[model samples]
Structures are given as C-alpha cells and as structure tokens.
Target: MCVVGIMVGLLLLFAAPGVGSLSLGFLFLLGAWFCLWFFPHDLAHHVVGRVLGVGFRYYFLGRSAITN
Candidate 1:
C-alpha cells in the first residue's frame, strides 16, 4: 500500500514538468494520496474474501491487535 502510494506520488510529480516547484502542494498531494489509498486497501480484503467464500474471524492492526 505504501509502495503504491509512493509510486503514484512520484509519477505524478515527474509526469508534470513544473509540478516539483510547488513544494507545499506536492507535500499535500502525497499526504492525501496515502490517506485515500488506505481505504481501498482494507476494503479489498473484505471484497476478495467474500468473492472467494472464505471468512475471516476478525482482522486487527496496530493498537487494536493488542486488545483483540
């Protein structure tokens, strides 16, 4: 997911010749790219699971895993 986000960011930058000159905008774009990408990454798991007819008892990450 991180790799995908980074690749998209870099590609957008290089693809537009003058894009790198806008420093603040570039940073904001990267931030938004990662945030938006995360949603579909999590959703992909659920969609694929149902399509394959496999069930996950539960899923956890970060601090949630400790309590779970």
Candidate 2:
C-alpha cells in the first residue's frame, strides 16, 4: 500500500499530458489492489483483524478469517 501510494505520487509528478494523471493514478490504485489481492496477509489487514477481535490466519499469499 505504501509503495503504491509512493508510485502514484511519482506518476502524478511525472506523468505526461497525453498519459493523463487521472489514468496514472487509477493504474497505481489498481496495482495496489493487485498487491493486496495477491498478498492479503499484509500488516494492514492483520492490524484491522486484531483491532476487531477476529481470528485471522496469515498465509504467504493471503489472509483469511476464522470467525467474525
């Protein structure tokens, strides 16, 4: 997520007129989503799960909840 944010910021700063900053931003967001989709065991989800008192399992590729 942080990497995606930084990439988006850089793209916005350097994106050409024809390339469109909005499109670049969207692409960056998409990439972030992809990262999360592929690696859902990230700290963000873990933190949220812990805060919500949910049982969570972190896999190498993704995370899953055991119970609500």
Q: Which portions of model 2 show Cα errors greater than 4 Å?
A: 1-20, 41-68
lDDT of each: 0.64, 0.58
Residues 16-63, model 1: lDDT tens digits:
445546776667666656655665676777888899999889776765
Global lDDT of model 2: 0.58
lDDT of 2 by residue, 1-68 (tens): 64565555555444433454777757765665555454444666677988999896644544555677
- True lDDT of residue 17, candidate 1: 49
What are the candidates' C-alpha RMSDs? 6.6, 6.5
Q: Residue 40: error of model 1 in Å? A: 1.7
